[model samples]
Target chain A: MNFALTSFRKDLSRWRQDLMQTAIWFAIPLTVGGLITMLMSGDGAQPHGVLLIADQDESFLSVLIAGAYSAGDIGELISVEKTTVEEGTERVNAGEASGLLIIPAGFGDAFLDAEPVTLTLKTNPAQTILPGIITDVTEIVLDAGFYAHQLFGEEINTIQSLVDESNDAAVAAIAVAIQNKIEVVAPQLFPPVINVEIVGPPATDVQVSLALLYLPGIIMMAVMFSSNGLASDFWVERDHGTLRRLVYSPGQLGSFVIGKALAAAVVIAIIGGLTLVLGFLYHGVSWAKFPSSLVWVALSGVALFSWFAALQMLFSNQNTASVISSMLLFPLLMAGGSFFPLAVLPGWIAAIGRLSPNGFVVDKLTSEITEVGAWIIDVNSWLIVAAAAASGLSICAWRLRSGFAQA
Target chain B: MLKVDELTKNYGDLVAVDQISFEAGKGTVFGLLGPNGAGKSTAINCISGLLRPTSGHASVAGHDVVSDGKAARQNLGVVPQELALYEDLPAIENLRYWGKAYGLRGAELDSRVSEVLDTIGLVDRAKDLPKEFSGGMKRRLNFGCGIVHKPPVILLDEPTVGVDPQSRARLFDMVEAARDAGACVLYTTHYMEEAERLCDSLAIIDNGKLIAKGTVNELRAKLSARDVLQLNGTFPLDETRQAVDTLIERDDLDLEVITQEEECVTLTLSRASQHLPDIFAVISNAGGVVTETILRSPNLETLFLLLTGKELRE
Candidate 1:
């Protein structure tokens, strides 16, 4: 055990000296994860696009439709500008806005009379997500209008006639009629009044951001990169002839293998810790679970590194082993939700992905982030990770004893 | 003391080492001399506990290699033919790691490492990595790693194969110092001169078999009655054979062909000086031209040729 620790220390010192390799390994996952998170996070999280609304109707209903997009949370995503038809078309064609919304002159009358009318939404071809969001929001507003006409057709018709006559006394009479009707029906409209009171201390629940949802996958990717770096060390040591010399010492070969694995675990932990801190600061990952999640991910990384180390023993050359391991790495990343979120995958694919070694760890991490107190008490997940680590280390030890690293 | 008793190692059907046995007491240097593929490494591997012997036993300082591997290995130091020091680590750091591997620790480890750095003559460059050192400096550090723990039984396997003359002389001095410090040294090399100069007793191996074993003078005495005559030049095979046949037909000249190549021929003569005139006439009559002629006295090289019927490097 002392010899193993000594070997571990030396290996770590060597890893520290290789600053360029360490920097490259750490950068790949951080850069990839950051770029992916920035691209996939939708307009719900931030301001998105410019929208030009050409309101030609000049009616109360037209103003109401336009007001739906100009206020509240939705307004933050789209900056709405009222413009003439010619101007709106020019702005959209000039790429000054993501989309143009035009309401025709007869739209209000058609909507009030329950007649079919087309509300034109011209989206820029160059923009994908922002323009698509504009189209979806317009469809939702049209649907709400249809429901409004169905429930209050008579009241809407009274307001329309007052507008047509352009008379103040007629609008006053219509308002009095609506007030009398509401006075009689108010008592029966809601027989039982249900009041909802928020009882808890102002809930600090943070809605999981899209980037946070993908944060676990990115963490797994970082672990994978660390594992690859660790696995390549076997070949490096062998090619340098140090491994064979070590065998001649009083230290057992098993101790050497364990020492190498432990050194890799340390590097993995460093990377996991840094990435989790980034996730907490930028993606709103729960700070309370950061320490435990980092530990879990680092253990998972050790298990993965052990498995790759065993695979490396089967290969004789560094370049061939690295190429094959990278080939395996990408597929594992894709299927394990490192490249794409498992939540977005089809049912069968996600099920398979969840069973992958990396996917299993990713699922546990994401659960710990989202569910309170789950990470602390998840014994089964920890046991699975331990079992994987044991199996991989056992294989590596057996191979080392069998002279797998010999030239 | 180091003892190897009938050590045999086999790889599938190929027997690499065949029942080799030898012993070296403290303060003595034992040499295992053989060409490439002569089971020298296999023998060393078995003795060092890296390989298990098929039908014999090896012990280091009375500790059995297979049954008490850790204790046996603790007392043994091996300098392999390959440069096995870490290139990324400084000389002092590499020595420290190997010293710890040999069970040295604390102040003793530090002191021993410093001593090895001084002994290898790299104390000034102890902080430099092996990659930054010259070939000679790296070889010295490679040797230093082996003796960092001051093991009693040291195995130096072809330690001076590719070193410069100065480094080779330095290694020789270190080996002498180790022997003077009461260490048993087992050195393997194919260089006959090295064996003659440094080894107190030597064993010559070929094709997994030990062909000869004794003190250098005792081994050389095997060829004291004969001399070696080497001729170098272009010679047709038929003409050389005819010349050799004619030379043997003469009653006064007793010669035996040691080796024949396209450009050179070597032969053992009972008395080279008295038979040289007739031997030259036979070669000249058979259309064989000799550009260079070398007459050698009894030595390890001649004994090696006499026993194996081939050159040591063949």
Candidate 2:
């Protein structure tokens, strides 16, 4: 154990001397995460799409269609601007808006009478995601209008004239009739016979920033690069002939393996801490959750470092080991959500990625950072990460004990 | 004290070291001399517990290399053929690390590190990394790292392969000092002069087998009855062969062809000085022109060539 500590100190000093390699390990993740955050953050404080509404109908229903996009959560995502047909067309063509919603002159009457009428939605070709979102929201509004007309066509028609004329008595009579109809139909809409209740915790409106979603993946990338650097030391020592000399020492080989792992863990912890601090300061990461999340990050790094260390032991040539490890690294990063958010991945791919070690640990860290008290309360993620780390270290120890890496 | 009893290491069908046996007592430098690809390193590795012998036993300070590996290693220090010092670390730190590995700690470790630095003549530059030092300084540090614990049995494998004369001289003194202080040193080298100067007893290995073993004079005694005579210049192969045959038949000359090349012919003969005139006349009569004729005394180089039919550095 004493020898292991000595070796660890020596390795730490050596790593410190290699300032460029150490700096690159930390810089890669920060730079990648920063660029991703900048790209995903969009051009404003809030991520919103510009939507132009051309109400050619000039009717109450047309007004309602325009109001639908300007209210609620969808309203936060879209900024609605009323314009003429010529102006809406020009804006969409000029790439000034995500999309233009044109309501035809007979849209209100046709929609109220349950007659088929088309609402033209022209999206800017230059915009992909935001324009698609605008088209989707417009479809929802048209669906809701069709369903309302189908369910209460007569009552809506009776109120339509009253709404247009702006007469007090007529409006009051129409309101009374609508209230009577709603009283008779409200029970059917909800269904007294079969009641649906949401059982989980109430949905909370948590405003997760792009940085929050991307930070964990970036941190995991940093861990991978750091672990790669650390694991490469085994080959470096072998090449330098220090490892061969150390084999003749009275100290157990297991001690050397443990010492190397300990040094790697220390470096990983420092890297994790630095990234987390940066996340907190520049990316709005929760300061209160930093300690727990950093622990997971460091553990993840150790797990990966041990795994690569085992590979280093198994392969005799350093170049072969390095090439294979690097080849494996990129796929792990891609599947582990280092390149992009897992939420954006296909469902099957995301499920597989979440089961991967990096993905699992990153998931735990992200949860810890996004939800207060999550890391402490979450037992399963901790166990999984612990199991991975234990398995990796176990393989490394067994290989080292066999003197497979002493070449 | 170190002892190797019929140490054999085989890699599948290839025998790297075959039943090689030798011993080095306290205060003696035992040299293992061989060309590249010989089993010198394999034997050293087996004795140092770096490799497990296939069919023989090795012990350091009475502890078996395989059975009592840890205890055996405690009594052994190994200077590998390669520079084993960490290039990024200072000489002192490298010594400190190796010292701790040998079970020294605290003040004892620090003092031992200082002593080794002083012994290697690098105390003044102890804080400098190996990369910042000259090749000779690095070689010295590499030697110091192995002996930091002052183990009784030390294995030096070609420690002066590329060292400068001054550093090589300094290392020779250090080795002598270690032996005088009661360390049994097992050294391997391609340089026959180094072996001739430093080793008390020598083992010449070839093709994974020990071909010769004894003190320098004892090995030289094998060739005391004969001397090597060389005739260099353009020589016809048929004429050289005829000359060698004619010399072999002469009653006054006891001569045999050692080697015959396109431009030179070497012969081993008894009483070379007394027979040189007749030997040169035989070559001249066979129409072989000799530009230079040289006679050499018996030495390790000649002994190696006579035994293995090759140079020690081949």
Candidate 3:
């Protein structure tokens, strides 16, 4: 064994002894992944909404239209509440409910008399998807009412007219007329209701894909954090005087850096591998991508650690190095689609994130995680990672040997 | 064997080590004696290849420290003033790490690590981290880490600094053991007793210059058997100078003034115990009262004071 290998073995032993630190580094991103998953309401989650109806008509037609929501599968997503127009308007305006429905005072009579009357829906602008669903249901109800008027307008008008005259005989005669109208139109109006089908179970429900969407970025965040930890170890070595001891040794300081980077790669690959395995099992990542994914992940770890180590060596003061490295980590995590999905982030943020050190790799890993991927794609990514690791670690080694520390 | 010739290091305006030179062969312990800010560390650093000398050069086992750093460093071992062991690692692992660093391998590396653990008396605590060890144990581990590869040339910079008497004794024994193994040891320390007890030959450096160089007895001989004499009382500066003028001029007396204060005066001369009464009579005649009198035989401590006109600890 030579000094480089010696350094590697030493760091490995140190990491083993300080298991809690490694565990925390690995645990943090997973914990963040879980919390963000809950926050984004993934795992087949459905958000419930409130619907307030203000019916001034208090008539049969108006009540029937409002009752339709409670009677259908749409009932699962929305709760129906009856209120006065003033209260309903206040609730919708306050964003306390999804939407408010207002039926005009003469709406029932106008519909029965084959006249036009308005049914107004006031949707909460603050609400996005739920208000739109409510609007769609309302439109369907209106279309059904219009077609019923076209089909049975004469019979309905006779029933309304007969109720005011000699009640028993007129009611019987109107019933027979409605029966005759239904028979005449029955063949042509087979299945009058429009059949709307949901493509899949995701009806306003956030699913596992939403959570998995952030996995690659968050996994990269974990890699960066581990790299940061690895870089700080150099500071410790410098402070403890072991680094000064290395100066007296015959080995090149470059070997020490290479050794430490190797250790970081191992730790990072394990994290990336385990997370990718979970992705493979439940999130549609192919098993065939594992080997390449592992190699890419480990290489990315070395690149990230090397860059962080370069940042550490850039300063003469250890405190400055520490502050700068810590400061660099979170912005990368935030902009790189680790904290929030790139699709949801503002355009400028996503652009900056994609340009960040770790963000491009994150984007590549997540682009088509559900589809089967090549062993590794985009040769430029490999070159970038390789170049970054080489240049950054080379800088660190050069600085270390160039009188940064005196023996 | 290790050799340094005109080794000089400059920090722009400050010369940390200037034109100092010496050589120590196998089985000899050469000591660099100086107080704080004496450039001892700079000189040793240059010799160990940890620092580049501004001009001049050094070599370890015949390899140039500058132009041939790796080869020179391979033959050299450094135990710095600071405890440089990895506190997170067990003592055995620390030994192994440094052993392998010097290019030891396979069975040889294991044997050397085990030997060092036993030699440092950490065999029982081999699996324990340095952080859990006592101050003395950690210091021993520090020493063990340096010599684990058994380099031909070793530099021990203030190895016994801040240690208890027992630990200091253990360190002295370790240095003697390495010397017996035919290693050329270059030890640096300010403690007069350690230099006298452990060093076979040494140099006294101050302000980046070597002031004196010889064996323990040889350097003491520079004092010419002049025992130091001290008198505590009120004495005028001019009167004290006038009082010692006569004896200073006499070659037989071999007298010299070490230091003079308002109420105290120290002087060194041959057989000062025999000349004390006469000295007291002369000071009395000069209107100076000797309230207390003390006399000591010559040693390196006194010689350093004689040569540098300052106390050894100063």
Compare the candidates by DockQ and give the number of the best one. Answer: 2
Clash list (residue pairs), candidate 1: none
> What is the TM-score of each predicted model, taking all chains together?
0.85, 0.81, 0.84
lDDT of each: 0.86, 0.85, 0.85
DockQ of each: 0.68, 0.72, 0.62
Q: Against the true structure, whose lDDT is highest? A: 1
- Per-residue CA lDDT of candidate 3, range B211-290, in tens? 98989989988887789887899988898789889768878778888888878888988888888878888888888888
Clashes of 2: 0
Model 2 over residues A1-407: C-alpha lDDT tens digits? 77778778888899899888878999999999888878887767766789998888999889989999988898888999999889999989998999999999998898887678888899999989888888888889878887777767887887776764767887777678778877988988766676678696534233477656888899899999999879988888878888788788875677787788888989999988898898777766546677788788887788889888887778878888999999988998999888976767899998889888787777677677666443552777677667777788788768755776456
lDDT of 1: 0.86
State candidate 1's DockQ.
Answer: 0.68
**Which parts of model 3 have CA positions greater than 4 angstroms off?**
A42-152, A158-208, A278-284, A368-371, A374-376, B232-234, B249-252, B261-264, B284-294
Per-residue lDDT, model 1, residue A261, is 83
Residue range A46-145, candidate 1, lDDT tens digits: 6478999898888999889888887788888888888988999998999899999999989988888788898999999988988988888889999888
